[model samples]
Target: MKRYDPALYAILALIFALSCAYVPLAGRGGGEMTIEVVRDGKTEFRAPLGDVPEMLEFRGPEGYNAISSVEGVRMVSADCPGGDCIRAGTIKNAGESIICLPHRLTVKLTKESASEMDAVSY
Candidate 1:
């Protein structure tokens, strides 16, 4: 049997840790993203799957009437009474959102993974 070298072991451990640290984690594969909107602040909107056109015609109170892609994610059309929220625009990154004060609605985007994201709060 060969003698164990403590120094060699420590160096190996350090290399392993450094390699793991540099390796891209599972959630780090994509660019930073977020969705921001205002919906009474109590409820949040789900990130839309399709493009801006598809989001416009969903046809629901919470459905987005006017949407814009500020960055990457889609800001769905809102049902705010004044139609202000509808015109707020789209967001797709950390720290972007739309607000509808009249209806107490807001939309915001975050860095959480798409699957993990509960709702795109703008």
Candidate 2:
């Protein structure tokens, strides 16, 4: 007959409890998202995730640039010489970002809290 160690049981219980606490947060990532556009180190525009896809245009020292977002965000167009931002592609996750150095622009996606979503919907 094998005996179970109390210390091992306690560790397993603790891990189970921690995993339970983490599941809800882990599942919250696909919640509503907001778009933040920063230019020249300042936030230039903020908007809710759009249902219809569209491009947002901006003019900077480097020239014109466009950012687009629907369920996912991307740099659709830019006048920068290398056009690296345009190639950065789509980002759908919170904390993901795309930067255009020539234009000093940044586009970031962020998850919205349940309370904030409720307020917006109502």
Candidate 3:
């Protein structure tokens, strides 16, 4: 049996970690999702997935609406008459949305599609 070198193991671990990180950045799939808040058919807020605040508040004609994104986008509180928006549940997947008809507000989750496959060139 051959002796194991500590440096070799560290190098291998670093390489593996880097490769894993690169795969997601290469646009293969599983890209970061975006949160889009639309009010009266206009985009009130739009941001890419990142450090989401504990509570995101938006002003509507009815009153204020609050949402959170700890795990996924969800309505935590609202001033609307009906609580249907709160019952919409957490929306994490792209195309999912929570609508508050009374408030005339909509929060939707979306993601950017990966680029087309690259062809090898000699």
Best by TM-score: 3
Task: Tell me how far the alpha carbon of residue 57 in candidate 3 is from the true structure, in angstroms, after superposition.
Answer: 0.4
Positional deviation of residue 16's Cα in model 1 after best superposition, in angstroms: 5.9
Clash count, candidate 1: 32
| Models sorted by lDDT, best on top | 3, 2, 1
Taking all chains together, each candidate's TM-score versus the true structure is: 0.45, 0.62, 0.66
Off by over 4 Å in 1: 5-38, 48-53, 56-87, 113-122
Task: Quantify all predictions' global Cα lDDT against the true fold.
Answer: 0.54, 0.78, 0.84
**Candidate 2 local lDDT, 12-109, one digit each (tens):** 99999999989667635556677888988899888777643487788877688887765478888888889899899899876678889888898987
Q: How far in Å is the alpha carbon of 42 misplaced in model 3?
A: 0.8
Return the TM-score for candidate 1, rounded to 2 decimals: 0.45
Pick the winner on lDDT between candidates 2 and 3: 3
Q: What digit string (tens of lDDT, one per residue) describes model 3 on residues 1-122?
A: 55898899999999999999997677555567889999999999988757567679998777789999888889999988789999989988777789999988999887766653233243
The ten-residue window of minimal lDDT in model 3 covers: 113-122
